[model samples]
Target: MTSKGLFVSFEGIDGSGKSTQARRLADTLTARGHEAVLTREPGGSPGAEEIRALVLQGDPDRWSAETELLLFTAARRDHLERTIRPALAAHRIVICDRFADSTRMYQGLSRGDLRAAVDQLHELMIGQEPDVTILIDMDPAAGLARAKSRQTVEERFEDFGVALQEDMRTGFLALAQEFPDRIRVIDGNRPEEAVARDVLDAVETCLP
Candidate 1:
């Protein structure tokens, strides 16, 4: 990696296996002798992790769409300040599980028509976009099934049901269209190794 470093975020509907791919990419890069900082949003830093517990482990409607947006934005700000920026400054590859695009979907488009507000907050506070974004495209039904099968308490979003997942899948694909240069969509219905290969290919252009 160059001194400028590289930021890569993985995005998908619940159970799209993006987290796995993110970790695999990080491990792959590290094995190649590159310093990679693997992290996740809403919980990357200490402060953000606290915020994560609040938003993730509650009733589906524990927080309103707007309130959730604010919470997510605040967490993102702290993450940028305390974790992401420093790692980039040190020239490490930042492999993030999710980023602003998530807020754009979950709290913005999917929850309500808060995309405008989401963008406004993002530009005002977290003015950084990942160099590359890997969007794992998966069937909403399948994704929701996988998500529910885990039975994790963080299923507040998943608890919203398959309809929400379907909407999110469409919204995510649209987001990829909106930012064609940065977001690359990969089919996640395939084997993990195959998905990881495509992910590596998507990111290869940005790597040193």
Candidate 2:
């Protein structure tokens, strides 16, 4: 790998299996003799992980959209400093589970119409964008059911129910269009192995 490295992120609605795919990509790349650093947003570094708990747990309305934005930005900043940048500098492929685009959809579009604010803050603080992003698109109802079945403490977003998931799916698809060069949309309603193969093909194109 070149010193410049490659940054990749996996995105999708909850239960769309993006996290699983991200991990698989990292493992696959590593096995193929590449140095791959797999991490996640809202909780990649220590400080960010703490912020993740705050935002992901408790009641659905725990924080206002504006406040949540601040927290997410701060966490991302810490994650970049502690985890992402170093790995990139070392010529490692950074496969992130979720990144700024997730924020653009979840906190920016879903919580409220704060897309402008999200963009401005991102430019000012975390200006980095993924070299490639794979978005797993799934049916809102089925995705919601899968998310709810997890029964994890991090179900605050899931608690908002299927209505929010439906809106999120539409928002995410629009986001893919907005950043066509960087984001690739993949159908996630199929078998996991098939989705993984598609994801690998997508990332391989961007590999150095």
Candidate 3:
């Protein structure tokens, strides 16, 4: 396996089924007798959940890109302090829906040069990263359609339209290239079971 138990995170555009797949993988692992701790970024812990509401439910321009990024970082920091770090310490597989990678892509789209700032914040504030990041790669258009099917105030970012989704797709792909050892790109254009099969396949090999 990779280490003892794995700290896995699912990454992709909003509608790439990362959240669903993260849960599915966690459930699968539990059914197999593994202690998989399922969580999500910006809302895993109580403090973080408060931040999630602040960040995700509001006008599209409620917060500037920089402000929004900091909020995400803060929520992540809280989540780590209260949720993720403890789970990893207990040797449980932690499968998170989204992590710092989403911040890197979304904030980078707002301002291309902000990646430097985001990286700095991540290194200084939220030092830990996922052991394995599974990127559910999908076409921006198709993913957008999937995202829109859900009605939520989180539509702020998605309302930016196809161009933003396109850029995010490119950004996430580049991330896979940058962190090849820690990241894996999986095709998300398949059936749920097929996608779940591939996700679990990627995870099981690294199982403790």
Candidate 4:
């Protein structure tokens, strides 16, 4: 089912301000006379929300890499069926805070064989790709610091230590390189407004 809408996803490390930027971008698009739907991964729909809590709060030490990937894919499937695909079908711009990229980064960090995982998962789900993916790149230390400052209670992934988080950041960069046509890496070390503007510009360039 094809539609005249754009799917833009925001990706980044823990504290790259992707959530904030995604909202700003949606508001900007709406102000420009476009219908924009702001949603997020792992919890876009009610069913996905339950899966999200399980994935986020579960013990990381006990969770296998394969298990993590499957849980993420499950949530994503629910999100696509219940939220993303429907919104796109209605010709509304969909801005997601995080999507498949997060699974690649997180699971890729824990598991070495990520290519096969991505291929298999994509083949099973994700019929359509995002028109643009704005990657808010930032240093792992800085990102984690920001996340720590803002959060009162840390989650499982947040407890993965700095090294794993750094690996995840690198993983995101690699994914961006692999899909350069659809991914735009933006230096997220700047002010929030500046980053938001850059994201908006990238989306504008990609969308019709």
Global Cα lDDT for candidate 2: 0.92
Model 4 lDDT per residue over 6-112, tens place: 89999988887888899999998999999999999878999999888877774657577788788878888899999998998889889998988887778855455
TM-score of each: 0.98, 0.97, 0.96, 0.93
Cα lDDT for residue 206, model 2? 83
Highest-lDDT candidate: 1
In candidate 2, which residue ranges exceed 4 Å CA deviation?
A: 1-3
Candidate 1, residues 1-208, lDDT tens digits: the string is 3368999999999999999999999999999999999999888999999999999998998999999999999999999999999999988899999999999999999999999999999999999999999999999999999989999878899999999999999999999999999999999999999999999998988897
Candidate 2 per-residue lDDT, tens place, 82-119, comes to 99999999888999999998889888999899999999
RMSD in Å for model 4: 1.8
lDDT of 3 by residue, 1-208 (tens): 3355578999998799999899999888999899989999879999999999998887777888898889999999999999888887788898999999999999855445589999999999998888889999999999998898898777877887878888999999999999999999999999999999999999877887
lDDT of each: 0.94, 0.92, 0.88, 0.83
Q: Return the TM-score for candidate 2, rounded to 2 decimals.
A: 0.97
Query: Candidate 4 regions off by >4 Å?
Result: 152-154
| Deviating ranges (above 4 Å) for candidate 1 | 1-3
lDDT of 1: 0.94
Clashing pairs in 4: none
Residue 170 displacement in candidate 2 (angstroms): 0.6
Instruction: Flag the better candidate by lDDT, 1 or 2.
Output: 1
Go through the candidates in order and give the C-alpha RMSD of each one to the true structure. 1.1, 1.3, 1.4, 1.8
